[model samples]
Target: MNKFEIFTNELLKWNKTHKLTNYNEDEIKKQIEDSLYPLEKIKDSKTAIDIGTGAGFPGLILAIAMPNTKWYLVEPLKKRYSFLNYIKTILNLKNVEVIRDRVEKANLPKVDLITSRAVMKTNDILKIIKPFLKKDSTILLYKGSNVLDELQDIDASIISRGNRNYLFIKGEKWAK
Candidate 1:
């Protein structure tokens, strides 16, 4: 099996004990695909952070896909952090760091890219990460079909790419 397959199986097995994700095999596959949809847009970033990285979705998968870019997986819960750390070890991932703290409490450095999924609303995310975002940094939010509605009052632009809707918001400080 490929690295992703191995990761999936291992995640599922660990989930049995830890309940990392509620997704089944098919759902996991779909989530992985969705997580990777923004890869090209963020491929050139030197550093990236995944906030609330439950089960290491985009962070771990992105780390596996992009070995050169450094990744920080920020997860608040202890159990999820342990699982992410274990996955990082088993995958022999040298470019990923599993952080066991909430984003607000963690002293994270500015990053070229920030990603989150099912974590919070657009405005709230922008507010929470405002301190960690640079002027040219990009924020990629994974949202469902109601993305348009979610971004209705937001000032940022929306870009549709790769079978997924990504809310692309950029600024040093967004009007939240």
Candidate 2:
């Protein structure tokens, strides 16, 4: 089994008791691969945040793929945090930190990119992360096929790359 496979199995064990993620083994693996595979555009990012990192879908996978980058995963639930901590410890991931807090409470440092999966609506997500974002920060959101409906209302330009839709909302605030 791959790292994500092992992680999914572990999560499944917890899910039976905690009801963490709704994805089965195949769905979980697909989500992990979808989350981690599209890094070419934002691969050079210095820091990243994954909001509502339920079972560490894109966040933990991103941390694993880009071990050199600083990664923050914000999850409010205590049980979820416990699972995340276990994964981190078992993987020996040094650049990842699981914050047991909601996204609303996240006073995140300026980061190059941010990602979310099954978190919130696209418009709401943009507004939620606005305060915590650097001027040039990009938002990578993973969504189902109907995401186009959500994007039609969003004012930002979007680049459809793989399973993710990347939005560079505004220019980077290199100084501010």
Candidate 3:
């Protein structure tokens, strides 16, 4: 089977014991598609951090798709954290790093990109990831129909497909 298939099977197996996600087999498959949908629209990042990476939505999937990009998948929940680590090992994702902590708590370097799927509001996310932002950094937020409402005054561009809104925001972190 393919790597995606292997990853899904492992996720479903772990979910039985860890209850990592409410998604069924089909939903998981759809989610994998959802995770990869941004590749065609965005440029690649040299380094990235995925916040609240539960069951490895866009983060792990993106890491798999962009193997050259260094990916740090930060998940706070114990079960989810363990599951992420397990998948990283089984998949032999050399560019992926699974962190067992909240995004705010984890000690990480500034990255060229930040990605979060079904996480939080656009503004709040910027606040949380402020320290990790560089002038050329970009953020990709995977959202739904409420994306426009959530964008508010944020100067972010959107690319919509089906129910998903890929919010692309440029980060500007000037040095002190």
The candidate maximizing lDDT is: 3
Which residue pairs in candidate 3 collide?
none
Q: What TM-score, over all chains together, does every model reach? A: 0.91, 0.84, 0.95
Model 1 clashing residue pairs (backbone): none
Instruction: Give one digit per residue, the lDDT tens place, for model 1 in 41-103.
Output: 789988889998998777888888889988999999999999889888988999999989889
**Which residue ranges in model 3 land beyond 4 Å of their true spot?**
173-176
RMSD of 2: 2.9
Worst 10 residues of 2 by lDDT: 167-176
Better of 1 and 3 by TM-score: 3
Q: Tens digits of per-residue lDDT for model 2 on 46-94?
A: 8988998888878898888888889999999898888999999988899
lDDT of 1 at 14: 89
Model 3 CA lDDT for position 51: 96
Candidate 2 residue 125 Cα shift, in angstroms, is 1.3
* lDDT, candidate 3, at 124: 83
The full ranking of all candidates by lDDT, starting with the best, is: 3, 1, 2
What is the lDDT for 102 in model 3? 86
